[model samples]
Target: MDQHIAEAIGRPDLIHLDERLVCLRFETMKVVSALAAVRHLLDTGAVRRGDTLLDSSSGIYAYALALACHRYGMRCHIVGSTTVDRTLRTQLAVLGATLEQMEPCSDLKLDQKRRVERIHEILLHHPEYHWMRQYHDDIHYLGYRTVADRILRAVGTRSLTVVGGVGSGASTGALARHLRTAGPGADDVELVGVQPYGSVTFGAEHVTDPEIIIAGIGSSIPFGNVTHELYDTLHWVSFDAALVGSVDLLRRHAVFAGLSTGAAYLAARHERARSPERTVLFVAADTGHRYADTVHARHEEAADITGLAPQEVSDLSELALPWSRMHWNRAPAPAPAPRA
Candidate 1:
């Protein structure tokens, strides 16, 4: 018998796209990570059989926590946004996860805060429920260690650069930290973070770009799990670029992934182009099957990114980012430097 659903969580596919790049494809990456967190809570005696699990998610994490709770015989609650689509709600319903969505906000930042506020209300009313603190807790970081190990074993003796969405800081931040210590050519491995155009984390002007549709990679608020030191460089990818990458990924590799995955794919391509010698690894967090129409109607390939002005570069030493206010520590940028 398959005694544990949690056993099915880790060891997602690591596909070598080419000599220079690979994709860490997951049916849902957070399912793997959330399982780790839940297991830790259980083993540490933080919670028992009767206790309930709770967290706030825009979408993915809610499904993940629900799945984890269902497998572990625990109850789950999700504080979500109005953006919580019918599909996800149905999945959560079947999984027996309760979702309370906050009022819709025209601005994403306000929406996130409202969700947090709702979580507070839920916690106050039901003080017995354990909050997973997906944004603020380090336990979420521990989940990605398995992924880092997988990357290490797959690309032994090669230079590597890990790039992906930095939402809540848990996935990319945690994965990069582990990869740094144990990955091949550990000393030289580069860690790059990708964010949306207006995510407060990267300090792009708070004015949300209508074109940037990727989520789960950037945030309106600073996430505790996203440690600034873990990243060597950061790129703020626009939605158009992410869409381009997403569609291209489907066409070239038949890898169906979400907007965040596309954004990460875009960043990975940028990294690979900058240094063809080093291997690039990026995660495709979820299936793009839901996005069937997003790229299928158009058949033309995405344009090549020039890596020019307004493009995200590693050196904030020269660029003035609103979030960093020029306080971010500087690192000399890797070569093939973009001309001013």
Candidate 2:
């Protein structure tokens, strides 16, 4: 009976091939770990009853927060963007959570500042609501640390190259902190953060390009959860590279992942090339089924490889962008190093 039950549970099959490569699938474990963390937080009085959890997520995190909050008998208020999947919205509504759609503030790119302003407005209007800001909350690290711990234990090594994209920077930052504090087995792990070249806020300031299509990661404003000191290295990837990675994952690994995952994968590949003999790990943030129309659309095949093909569409004159093109890729120059 135990054997039958184990088979039914469907654990990820991990293959350890030599010291250089260790393939570990902790996706299912991650969800369970996140839920367990939520339960622990509720039980330990870190998250009290009747507190309204406010999350600024496009979809996945919103659903996780709603489901967890519902299970714990806590109210959830999701400040969702217009770009969020309708199916996710329906699920949240069914869970009895209130969803407020922030009016698009002259930006096709979901502006984080606008979302934050709406959240502030909601708080001001409803003083009874206790915003469980996931970005800055310490408990957000609880589940993320589990992932890093699992990687360290499974590989049986201290020197690891961890690569992942930053949404709110909660998971990425937490994993970095955990790896830094690990015992003898994980003393020299390096955490690298990847972001879209269009919206590079955490690593290095990049001008937000209006033409770029940002899917999962990258924030319009600097999130409270990310600290520049925590990251060992940062790489900015173009949307074209991310798209190629996404297509490659779908074709080769049969892994349907979102654009953010693609961005991270491409960055990981670059990092892997730098340290070819070392073990590199990347996070598959979410499934790509949600992006069937946008990223996976057959119509975008030609435009997707535009950076490589010169014949691809390049007329921005016909494209309508909400923000001025002047601000695109016009980031302020990096400050000079201090003299010793």
Q: Pick the candidate with the highest TM-score.
A: 1
- Candidate 1 lDDT, tens digit per residue, 1-340? 5556655654589898877889998887888778889989999999997589988898888888988898888999998977788899898998888888877777777888888888888889999999999988989988888778778888743578887887888888787778777734676777777777666665554434665446788877667666877777777767666777787788788888888888788778867887888889898888886565565444465564343223334443343321121223323322332334
Residue 219 displacement (Å), model 2: 1.0
Please give the CA lDDT of all the candidate structures. 0.75, 0.59
Q: List the residue pairs that clash in candidate 2.
A: 158-185, 158-186
| lDDT winner | 1
Off by over 4 Å in 2: 1-41, 44-47, 104-110, 203-210, 298-340
Model 1 residue 147 distance off true place after TM-score fit, in angstroms: 1.4
State residue 220's C-alpha deviation in candidate 1, in Å.
Answer: 0.7
Worst 10 residues of 1 by lDDT: 321-330
- Number of backbone collisions per candidate, in order? 0, 2
